[model samples]
Target: MKKILLVALAFATVQFSSAQVETPQPSPASKMEQKVGLTDVTVNYSRPGVKGRTIFGDLVPYGKVWRTGANKNTTISFSDDVMIGGKELKAGEYALFTKPNAGSWDIYFYTDTNNWGAPRKWDDAKVALTTTAKVEKLPFNVETFMILITNIKTNGASLEFVWENVMVEVPFTVPTDKKAVANIEKVMAGPSANDYFDSATFYYDNGKDINKAKMWIEKAVELSDKPRFWYIHTQALIYKKAGDKKAAKKAAERSLALAKEAKYDAYIKKNEDLLKTL
Candidate 1:
């Protein structure tokens, strides 16, 4: 009986030792990542120490500019033109930096290529954009630096930043449809006109006003015969809508001729079929 009891005691001790020796599973960390633009350029970075640990002046140092976060310089690339910090940034990558304070912070955009360090040498930067942030009046400590984009719209967006007892917001605007249209028209009026014609066709396919569509197609037709098929097809549809059978037939024939020359056999066949009914 004594030997059996000793054997059971030894087994319990081994089980407790095994439990203590077991390796602990690591807790997952949330990394910052976002996507932007038509091609969906991915932006990713690590969020380092923030609130409870003490940042800026205590952990990060106040007077010096910080790289903002660790691992890869907090890159943001635009697939197209974007207005950031009230200034236009063309499609490219930029390194982010910040000047921190208790009340407000100055956000900076560095054009420097190497994103390894913070403000090592600002003289090499191409340009810098400054924006002010409004700090909150709360005593919550942040453990990780963070950024979020909210209230996104076609015309503009709000870029937000948060850390420790503060939050900053910057309003950013993208090119509006009206502005794009005006710019396209200006480009069309330039020396090489076909480029503009292509632009008009793009706008039309995207559901622009029919009257504007008709006007742009007319401009395309006047510029060169290269877009003749598109212009003729559009004019034929317009004529059909206006109940002008004679004009519709003429335009359809023109479209068929242009399509045939361009080896657009499918377009030629479709336009010819429509012409037969007229």
Candidate 2:
């Protein structure tokens, strides 16, 4: 009985020890996210160490498609359309693959984002964007694979990859100013009812031109089927500023009725205050 009990206890202990053991990974996963202008850029990859081996032409053979990382295919995500290497790429996620050489590196953006490393048989039809970047030798050795977003500006940035003694940079541009200016021009050409109301309120508050304020506020009220309490209140204020107490009191009363129906306490109080002054 004692010998049987000892054998069972040893078996249980071995099972627990085996379950607790953890193996280390040779390459570890990493993620980077950045915002350039109004666009968001993200990268998911795995980092492999140098391990004292020649990287460029020996381990990661030259003139071959690399995973751009280790273990899994590297992925890059863009939130907005951008111009990369002077080629337009629509906003989306893509797998980053590369072909390295002594002089230049060819960077590929593939639509296939869920593959393990660079597949032996990758379809050329899956390639979305391809660009070439000049290879530059680094002054110091990088012990591990590194990816960086550098040279950040309001309209563009540079994506850099560094490993061992090799470095490559891919430049991209965002059309921030162009989009903003176009939107501004559009709004300026066609002013909405709210724009007229806001301009009237600005003019009335600043004591600029009472007649102009009245014209704009009237236009705002005319355009609205059911005028807002705030707009009616602004109309009352403009009348009061122009020294027309009767018209001001009438507009304030209308504003109070709308405020009560909407259950807006702040507008109700403002209308009451204006009426009291009249």
Query: Judged by lDDT, which candidate is best?
Result: 2
Clashing pairs in 1: 50-142, 50-143, 51-141, 51-142, 51-143
lDDT, residue 174, candidate 2: 84
Candidate 2, residue 267: Cα displacement in angstroms equals 32
**Residue-level lDDT tens digits of model 2 in 128-191:** 8999999999899999998889998989999999999999999999877877788889788687
Error of 2 at 272 (Å): 38
Off by over 4 Å in 1: 1-42, 178-278
Clash counts for all predictions? 5, 0
Give the winner by TM-score: 2
Candidate 1 versus truth, CA RMSD in Å, comes to 11.8
Model 2 score (lDDT): 0.92
The TM-score that candidate 1 achieves is 0.50
